[model samples]
Target: MRRAIYTGIEAFGSILEGNPKKNVIALPILQEVSDLPCDTGSELKDLQIEIEQKDLPVDLRFVEENWSEKSGKYEPTSEKIRDRAREARCWLKERPESEIVVVSHGGFLHFLTDDWEDGHKFEGIRQSHHL
Candidate 1:
């Protein structure tokens, strides 16, 4: 998680080189809304601190819902993933920013973009599907 967070910060830094006020938002890795037992908010909180310490000219925001994964163990279904993805897509469309940078995990990203064509090729360690 630490490595991922650092790598994300580095990537964000690179993006900032071209545009300092690039709108940035992140999908919760494991937030309060998640049904998962463990949460990654602490690590993300640390990420927020690091962003501040580095003096990066951007405000990182999070989606209220944990749309990254299924709600809980019992509600395991692809339908839910699709619904959440649609919800996320709609929320993004409502944002005022003309160009927003969304930081998210690969699996959920697949759903968010409604693209499942590259499933086989992106198997294992493929964490990004570029927009």
Candidate 2:
């Protein structure tokens, strides 16, 4: 039983340490429809503090894409997503040894993977596949 406990503890430790803690680039989403009710600026500030506490870098940017008020939905234009991916790809490419955390909307993440959809479906941005 003691041996089993030790093994379990070791496994948990490995799981925690295996993943590299590094920079995270957050993607901007609609504040009105986000999970958090707080403003984007406040959220960003909080996220920055969390990243700092975790000994990681917080590198974030807002996509320059604007949606039409009349349409009441995001346009099918890939420019914004493309721009975000470009930035992420550049950072990842430069530092092949480091791990990056991208905090963005589900749609933006999908765009990074080149799999855009009308609905909010998450297929996850697999690091290995993209890098």
Candidate 3:
């Protein structure tokens, strides 16, 4: 059984700060490439920088999703989110018994999980929790 750690963007810093593990993975939106103010890139970059500065022992990897030109959206359900879900499912299939930590936007996190339903919303990052 693979344990997943889903968390929003802003809290990634504090979460990594507290957790000293070396096997964490970060999932970022592929189509949405720019690090805009409230986008995934910004948050991921922030966490990356923090990790570098703090010299934490966590290993980070990103999962990329294809973008849809017809929809003109980064994470439309049928396109980006679904692709990410497939990728995660495939990864889980190969390694079905690993604990993975994912730092990404709330919507993407929900899309990756089996328990989350549509229309679910998560507030922006507030505080980070330690493992």
Candidate 4:
């Protein structure tokens, strides 16, 4: 999560440097991590602190449960994943931001982005959880 935030800041800082009118909003999905002891609530709080300390213009939106992990213990079927992805895509399309940066686990990244051509792209995403 930290890496993704840092990357987003670094990646977009320059492009948005001189544009005061532009806005950057972060919508971290409300995901459940079964592998981890706790959930992402604390992480989001910490992230909020970091953003405040930096005085970033990022507007932290509500926790989006739509993109959360699989509902059951077992892994979701491919069709289910696709359905979730489609639903996520629909939700995202309604957002006001012109550009959005998503930072999520490996299992959901491809599904969210619909970029299955390059499997290696998601190699760095954590493997502790799956969608």
Best by TM-score: 4
TM-score of each: 0.52, 0.37, 0.46, 0.56
Candidate 2 matches the true fold with a TM-score of: 0.37
Deviation in angstroms for 59 in model 3? 1.9
Rank by TM-score (best first): 4, 1, 3, 2
* Candidate 1 wrongly placed segments (more than 4 Å): 1-15, 18-20, 29-44, 63-77, 120-131
lDDT of 2 by residue, 12-127 (tens): 44543445553233334322122222312344455546556765433444422332121223323344336546665665578666544333445455656666456544233223
Ranking by lDDT: 4, 1, 3, 2
Query: Cα RMSD to native, each candidate?
Result: 7.3, 12.3, 10.0, 5.5
At residue 124, candidate 2 shows an lDDT of: 34
Point out where model 2 deviates above 4 Å. Answer: 1-14, 18-44, 48-78, 98-105, 117-131
User: Would you list the C-alpha lDDT of every candidate in the order shown?
Assistant: 0.50, 0.39, 0.44, 0.53
lDDT tens digits by residue: candidate 3, 81-107: 566566766766676546644544444
Model 3 residue 53 distance off true place after TM-score fit, in angstroms: 1.1
| Residue 20 C-alpha lDDT in model 1 | 59
Count of backbone clashes, every candidate in sequence = 0, 1, 0, 0
Q: What would you estimate as the lDDT of candidate 1?
A: 0.50
Residue-level lDDT of model 4, residues 24-124, one tens digit each, is 55544413223233323345566678879987756667544332333442134444546656666777789788876665556556766767775553243
